[model samples]
Target: MNSIPASRRWMYDRMYTGRRGLKESFVHGVEKFITIACQQQSYVNEGKLRCPCAKCQSTKIDGVHTVRLHLFKYGFMSNYYIWTDHGEEMANVDNNLIGASSIGINATECETSNSMHDMVCDALRQHGAFDILENSNVEEPPNEEAQRFYNLLSEANCPLYEGSSESKLSMCVRLLACKSNWNVPDECVDFITKMLLDVTPVNRCLPKNYYDAKRLVSKLGLSARRIDCCVQGCMLFYDNDYGKNDGALLQCKFCHMPRYHDRNTGSSTKKLVPVKTMFYLPIIPRLQRLFASVQTAGHMCWHYQNRSTSGVLRHPSDGEAWKHFDRVHPDFAADPRNVRLGLCSDGFNPYIQSTTPPYSCWPVIVTPYNLPPEMCMTKPFMFLTCLIPGPRNPKAAIDVYLEPLIDDLKKLWIGVQTYDISKKQNFMMKATLMWTINDFPAYGMLSGWGTQGGITDKRRLYGVGKVTSPLTDVDTLINVSSGRATEESEKIIQLEEQVRKSREEARQSREQNKRLQCQFQSLFNVVLPLLPSDTQHILQQQVDQQSHDNHDDQQPPPTGHYGDDY
Candidate 1:
């Protein structure tokens, strides 16, 4: 290690007690360092130089402006007195630099580095996991899936901006969560992001819009697949056979309804739009992701690990249904990692207060019961598997929408190779659909039963005995007919009485108004003849204008008035 220079001792103690009580000398040092670093042409690569901040420690390369900002915020790394990484040279300096080993990771550096990344590395290290760190043993390389997950982790660890504590992954997640919680439209979200970009000082890493945000976050591997469905919900335009071209069919096989809305017959350049679409979020990848995370992997076995044996029914594991399932499927229950999932679905109006035409949208949610009761029921644990599109409820036709989910469920039951981060091993993990939750109408639709007091058993039938109408008896029929006639007669009598009173009051008011107008006209005529010629002219004009106004008021309104539209 090179000895620290006497003149540059301020680099070690970047802060000092000044008139302001405590002031940062780090900003001045960062400015001087950046000026010197930028002068080394040989060390600069593509207009960028190595950042020697505490967090980066010469590992990250950035432009001069970003390097200065990072150095000012996090200060220099420990024992970096020589600045060798930034083209600085010293006589007889050791090539094996100080603080290069994993053991030498100091508190300041760790605090400045990405906290989430540190937690992930620590958890993996505890399980004897390898391949995450570049220096880890490469004798046994990670499998394709694990390698992909590590790549995603690296992308997620990237900071949102230079010297920012928040990561790109976390920022994107928060933005998406806000969008969902407030039911904000995609266009609105895009507009808000543009506004955010304008207000922010450093926006290079910030997403430009909603699409950019989604694209960046998609690296996490959780995404929905939009499959075209029949407008009538007869069947999905999905093909299991790779060799078959049935999925490309323009019309439904069962209903023969056109796949797209009517378009110009001669226009081949137009896009083929699906009349209906269902978004299916694959369950296998999500289930694998649960095992991939150290925090959630151990929680997946919480039900088995913390089973209540005191005869208290605190969790679903204590229920008879769970016990029966375990007894019947001993092989599946042998491993605590095997997932038990419960499905739930319901329809809701997306536009609750809108005056636009109403429509129902059904979302199918799946929850893993392997987690503890409290965690399994929470919103974060509840995964939305499918979004069934609807202008109307799917009803019994919901089975068509659930086809993709059912196929995934079947595959999960068989088992898939998954890597468990907590166990640091790969195993064939299995899952099963334990039950379904829904309201009475949804239950009837899912089970193919009538919601109106319908029983499943054929032996027992409701309202099976012979029934007769109340009007079957002649006396009852006569009495009902007489009562209806009497009610109608009373209504008519009351209506006529109201009409007579209104007409009589109107006639009396008209007569009174006519008498008053005649008396006023007679008095005006008598006064008009006694007036001088100039005065008479003005008085005549006033009389004529009053008569015209009265004539207009007495006349009926035009037959085709604008108010008739209502």
Candidate 2:
């Protein structure tokens, strides 16, 4: 199959009057196109093919006949003459032929433009922001937010150089991905990017350094906010109250700890840097972003849409906790797009296997349970909400660090206006924190539970140098002091009685076994004398073997299965 270049005017030009439909030549061209597409891919035999009509734009999969009808109605998408999505390879086409057909523009330039355009469109489509570029019904100009998004999209489409396939946004994104995957240092990335720019064409559009690349990418609306925190984790210097003074508080209100390190006596011009700081990634914008893409927007409803009916606990949605939540908040549950989240936080040594001093950093991760089981816990979906810097565990003071996250949760509970890309409409999207994930000590820190003592009762407090009986419950002690038989004391008495009964039964069984053994020995001695010499010898051997087996069973088990005898 041959690719018809976009410069072939007859393929796209309308050549018919109102009464008659498309010209016979165009119809013949469509028929030949369909025949070649079907012949190139085996999947088209399954009764469907990717429609390349301008309306569908190869995004919609439809029956072969329907695709043909769409082409007849709307014509093929512009510059889709390559048919790369179906089977035609761009490498097979002659660059000189494409260049000659398309006026002054050469094949490389055209290909680069197409590639950048497709890349930008695909990204916007996934983010559910494609409508901003595609929609033509707006009478008024785009708002500030929409206009900003459009500018970013334009930058993403701008090529790095005149014939280069890489765009400014693409280069920045690839560089960032490489930096993250390889743990590359900022200085190294700056050096490499600088070297590339120096060697490349003078008209290059690439970012100057690592920071420049990061700045360009940060405009995508997923940037983190850094907030100074107290060294003792007492409070954060955030919110509007601190805005006027620019968070210039000198010390923590609770602990009276200095907010910043002591300044050098000689260096009076040194900046006052915070003793500790945490990075907080707001949850609302992230949750809204999830519903922007059609793929993820549909998935965000999987918990409700794919709710199990067989009464099996396959997913969190199948559990009673989720159902009870729905019963309590019907309004939130009514909208499948409303998110349900699980928060998880843990402290780990970031500098593993190092000789450096011991340090712990806590990362608070938020997972949306709206996705299916397979996707809900994946790294991509696990949103890192905060990074708590530490030289030691926050312990009970962890709540002080969680204040910002709690504020975000409260706002989410009230609801936020979000665009649902799958539905193509705006709706109030609310979210609730269903539960928390943490280890025992972390749980104690988060919930104020005394995990160090009282296994059955979490509320019981035990302090240093305090004397208490391990077996006595708080209620039992109080009842004993009052000389009253309380429920706890009665329960303890019942347990003791049950233990006594079990011991008595065990003793009776042991006595019965001894009596039976003695009777068997007496009977064996009586029968031994009446037996013949050979029969007596065999009977004695059997009795001896049985005794030996019984002795072995009473002894401790061997440490290993494969012993020297075996």
Task: Give stretches of model 2 more than 4 Å off.
Answer: 1-122, 127-129, 132-147, 162-164, 240-246, 268-270, 455-566
The alpha-carbon deviation from the true structure for residue 73 of candidate 2, after best TM-score superposition, in angstroms, is 26
How many times do residue backbones clash in model 2? 0
Mind giving the per-residue lDDT tens digits that candidate 1 earns over 1-566?
A: 13334446667676554633223555666677777777765345368876777776554567778888777667786656655455444223432322122224344543533244444333222222233222322333445786686777666656667756555665666677668778889999898889988998887777888988788777767788999999999988887522435688899888799888877779877887788899999988889877875446767877776678899999888876677667777998899999888878899998877787889999999999987664677665689998999899998788878877777776777788887754556788888776668886886666554446212221012211111211111111111112344455455445545756766776677677779989999998888889899999998898889988976665533433222232
lDDT by residue for model 2 over 270-343, one digit each (tens)? 79878899999998878877776443566687776567889889888887667766766688788888888887
TM-score of each: 0.56, 0.59
CA lDDT scores, all candidates in order: 0.66, 0.66
Per TM-score, the best of the predicted structures is 2
